[model samples]
Target: TVNELRRQRKLMEKLSMEDHLTGLPNRRAFFDCAERQVEFSKRKSEAMALLYLDLNDFKGVNDTLGHDVGDELLKSVGKRLSTVCRKSDLIARMGGDEFVYVLPSTGKKGSREAETRIHQAFEDPFSVKGRSLKLTASVGIAVFPDDGKTIRELLIVADEKMYENKEKLSRESKRVTIT
Candidate 1:
């Protein structure tokens, strides 16, 4: 009984640190991991990047295909991100079709390259169950020291940049559709 209790506790702890849908790290876990990465980057005098990403037009998927399909798409996105990003990178689900990545020791060039890889990841349509769906995300990158020294500051700046990119994409999409 004691062993069972301990096992259950450990499972609970793991679950607490993970996102239920994507199986990526939850926001709290991300913060913990990123805090350490930030310290490491600072000590080493290495530039790091915080990437904030938001799914484009994700609500449409949920509306047309239902929540189950939407959830599967989210999972697929997480998998694709892992494939493109470095193993050392820290990825987290920031809830509601948003994610964040902490790329330690990556400066502007590396972050840009990672962002391009991220875009390429979505070039192929996702096969979720029976439906084939295309997805894209707006990614914002903020380099450490130049952008922000601390995780909190970096996150805030990245988030703002992501929203701006999202808006720009939305406008471009609208214009194309209109024309």
Candidate 2:
């Protein structure tokens, strides 16, 4: 009976830290790990990068294609990100159509390279429910010690940058359309 209780507890803990849809670490898990990483970076005098990624036009996908297809798209996105990231990197789903990545011992240059790879990963269409769907994400990167000292502070900076990036992309698309 005790062993069974322990197993249940372990499963609960795992479920608590995981996103049900994508099976990636959830927001709670990301924050917990990120806090530790930030402290480690501070103690070791190492640089770290926080990337906030928000899918562009994700709501449209759900609206047009249905939730099942949208869910498949999110899972595919997670798999792509996992492939792109290193073992040392921490990638998590931060709720609907949003993900966050923590790159330990990485600076601005490394973050930019990671961003490029992420964009490249999305270049190909995602096949879900026999339909090929195109998607892109707005990525915002913040380097530790340069951007913020705490995880929450870094997230705030990264979120703001993500919005800025999204706006920039919107403007660029509008310009292209106008031309």
Candidate 3:
């Protein structure tokens, strides 16, 4: 029984980085992997990317539908995002409606491609609570060793970009004119 307990403990530790809800890696685990990538990039003098994303109109979904449906939608989004990302990429939920991704050994081109893929993933409809829901996400990206020398700075820049995207969307939403 003791050996069995030890084995189970090891398995749990291995899976600790994963988010139980969305099955994406959790924030703590993501940071651990990102730190390693940052160190490697520093040595090779290569560029890496950090992408910060937030679901657009997610709060409206919760308000219009319910929290249960909102949770299901998040899980679906995570699954779709995982399919679009490379095996080397790290995707994680930073709590609430926020997510962060790390693309090691990738620069501007890679970041652009990844962002495009993610946006395309959201173009499809998601089934939640037996209903279809359309969703969009705002993405902000920062390149390592160019945008910031530290992870904190990278996250701040990425968050700033995300907020800028949100503001743009809000402005666009108010611009529709009906004849």
Candidate 4:
């Protein structure tokens, strides 16, 4: 009985850390891992990058295509992100079409490269339930020691930057429509 209980506990822990739909690490897992990474980076004096990404027009997709299709799209997005990231990188779903990436031992240049790769990955449409859906994400990046000393602080900065990027895109789209 004790062994079975232990096994159940282990399973529960694993499930708690993973996003059920996308199979990516959940927010709690991200924070737990990020805290350790931040400490390691500080000890080694290494640069790290935190990226906050939010899907653009995700709500529209859910409303138009139904939740099942939206869920599939999230899973596809997760897989796409995994393909673009290195073995060392940490990718997590921060719930509801928002994801976070932790790049250890990476600086501004590396972050920019990663961001470019992510954009390129989105160039192809994701197929969900026999439908082709185009998706884009607004990414905000913050480098360690430059942006913040702690993971929470870095996340805050990254989230703010992501919102700014989303606003810029919205404005640019409006301008293009007007012209």
Candidate 4: where is the Cα deviation over 4 Å? 174-179
lDDT of 2 by residue, 1-179 (tens): 99999999999999999999999999999999999999999999999999999998888888877899889999999999999899999999999999999999999999999999999998888878788877788999999999999999999999999999999988776210100
Candidate 4 per-residue lDDT over residues 78-105, each given as its tens digit: 9999998999999999999999999999
Give the alpha-carbon lDDT of every model.
0.88, 0.91, 0.87, 0.91
Ranking by TM-score: 2, 4, 1, 3
List of clashing residue pairs for candidate 3? none
Candidate 2 regions off by >4 Å? 174-179
Candidate 1 — what's its lDDT?
A: 0.88
Flag clash pairs in model 4.
none
TM-score of each: 0.93, 0.95, 0.92, 0.94
lDDT of 1 at 127: 83
By TM-score, the better pick of 2 and 3 is 2
Question: In terms of TM-score, which candidate is stronger, 1 or 4?
Answer: 4
Q: Encode model 3's per-residue lDDT on 72-167: one tens digit a residue.
A: 989998998889888888999988889998999899999999999988998778888788887788999999999998888889999999899989
- Write down the TM-score for model 2: 0.95
Candidate 1: Cα lDDT at 158: 93
User: Which residue pairs does candidate 2 place in steric collision?
Assistant: none
